[model samples]
Target: MADNILRIAIQKSGRLSEDSLKLIKECGIRFDNGAGKLKTNATNFPAEILFLRDDDIPGYVEDGVAHLGIVGENVSEESARDVDTVHKLGFSRCRLSIGVLREHDYQGVSDLQGKSIATTYPRLLGQYLEANGVNAAIHEISGSVEIAPSIGLADAVCDIVSSGSTLLSNGLKEVETIFRSEAVMIASKHLSDTQKTLLDQLLFRIKSVQAAKN
Candidate 1:
């Protein structure tokens, strides 16, 4: 037998995980979210929560494995999954910015021509560079993008910036903001009638909680 309860995916760890759990708790969905659990069934609501990497949430929802997901917009956009964003929760705010060594004499994006860049988001970086008509070698790296310039791996780097602290520590300065992002709620494109009704109920609760916070 299959469970009819809705499944929601959230970040296993990182900036979005704690807040995602808080949102579910605020929505009155009581569940045992002990440490190290991958999935949990709600005791008071007809929902199941799955903890996973934020990067994987978009695909999971798009594939209908999860009915809903909470993830950062940076990930959602970069992944380009077919899921729909139902709500933009005003938290985990950040921006994807182009950073260079603090000593670089950068006047504008044009200065990046023919320069090597390191980033995890190659697609997003490529689109921005193409739109600006700047040609730069993109060195795709999974993490520690800020260290690229220091290690002679790249002339500039594109990465997420919240407070500019990480870049500062790496002797880099943010020169341009290419993308702004925050936590958002995404849903599967296809939903059954029953699933839609349940989704409506969940949305109502989320809206109510958000309204109360404001």
Candidate 2:
């Protein structure tokens, strides 16, 4: 049931979307990406692009609904999906860091013991805490994680930090970096021969673009 056109899922908006589309363009693939469109077919390549929330990309790829995806390593690791990382795009670099009130005493990971932490990445935070044997309670929140410490929602917060400005402005300071992340391309575990052939061509173009930039 595999079609000649391969499908790739990418972030609909936010940090990763623009770079994802730029990568496609650099690969010499042409498509109409009008706002409000969920999907579009490539005019010059045998592929289709599906615009979706970054959170949903892994699942779609894992389920083979999408043959491939572009997302941040932070999300890819957290989702723990059965997709394979095809290439690292080297964009959208950030770290998953643990932050607490600037005035709070944080000697080490041990300081987090018996504390409450707010984060969107519960699984990753949990793994880090467990590895350090710091049995802290995780308060999973979808957004405004920086406010967790100020509003007394939690003693610490774990979230993505780019320049640390968000944490600094919120009266929080990063005490530990749990994980480093960058944009990456992921493919479904199973791909038809035709799809794999097309993917190889896409990868060649992508590598050429990346090489030209570096």
Candidate 3:
């Protein structure tokens, strides 16, 4: 029974989670997502939803633990997981950017040469730097990347920018955009025939829902 159902992984909480659930509901899938519930089954669809950390969703999908996942492009690319990006949900859009102290007389990406940049997205930052011919040192940190420059941990920071309010509050200014990200649907490369059919149906409904918005 459960073996034949499609498993979808989503963030347990946050704006991404809210948007993901809303999209699911718009697709006519009903499910109970009560507080503290980690997993739920859709009442009228052949799907089960697994609530998890945003970062873990990619890995779960890659491992086939969850046949599909709704994750931000940032986390998906950062994880470097082996998964197929099935669709772009068009919500939760943001950019990975490099920021430096507001008063640093910043010029351009070349200004990052030989400087240390703190970020949670080292792989993306490293790649961007390599492509730009910048030789900055990447300081990978789990959190508080915005405060790195203020505290002297790094000369600049590479992190997600939404409203840029966080960077303004931290006395930093955006210098370069390394990546643009949005909510995206990712799927395991390996899927059973039944699961594939269910996924196709779900994608159709999702597209219809998105289309109705425009």
TM-scores for all candidates: the values are 0.97, 0.98, 0.98
In angstroms, give how far residue 75 of model 2 lies from its true place: 0.3
**Candidate 3: which stretches are off by over 4 Å?**
none
**Cα deviation in Å at residue 153, candidate 3?**
0.7
Whole-model Cα lDDT of every candidate shown, in order: 0.93, 0.94, 0.93
As for lDDT, the candidate ahead, 1 or 2, is: 2
RMSD of each: 1.1, 0.9, 1.1
Model 2, span 1-214: residue lDDT tens: 4567799999999999999999999898999988899999999999999999999999999999999999999999999999999999999999999999999977999999999999999999999999999999999999999998888889999999998899999999999999999999999988988899999999999999989988
Q: In model 1, where is the ten-residue run with the lowest total lDDT?
A: 1-10
Give the C-alpha lDDT of model 1: 0.93
Residue 117 of model 1: what lDDT?
93
How would you encode candidate 3's per-residue C-alpha lDDT over 1-214 as one tens digit per residue?
3558999999998759999999999999999888899999899998899999999999999999999999999999999999999999999999999999999998788988999999999999999999999998999999889999998999999999999999999999998888999999999998988898999999999999999999
Candidate 1, residues 1-214, lDDT tens digits: the string is 1336789999999999888999999999999988899999999988899999888999999999999999999999999899999999999999999999999988999999999999999989999999999999999999988998998999999999998899999999999999999999999987777778888999999999999989
For model 2 the local lDDT of residue 57 reads 94
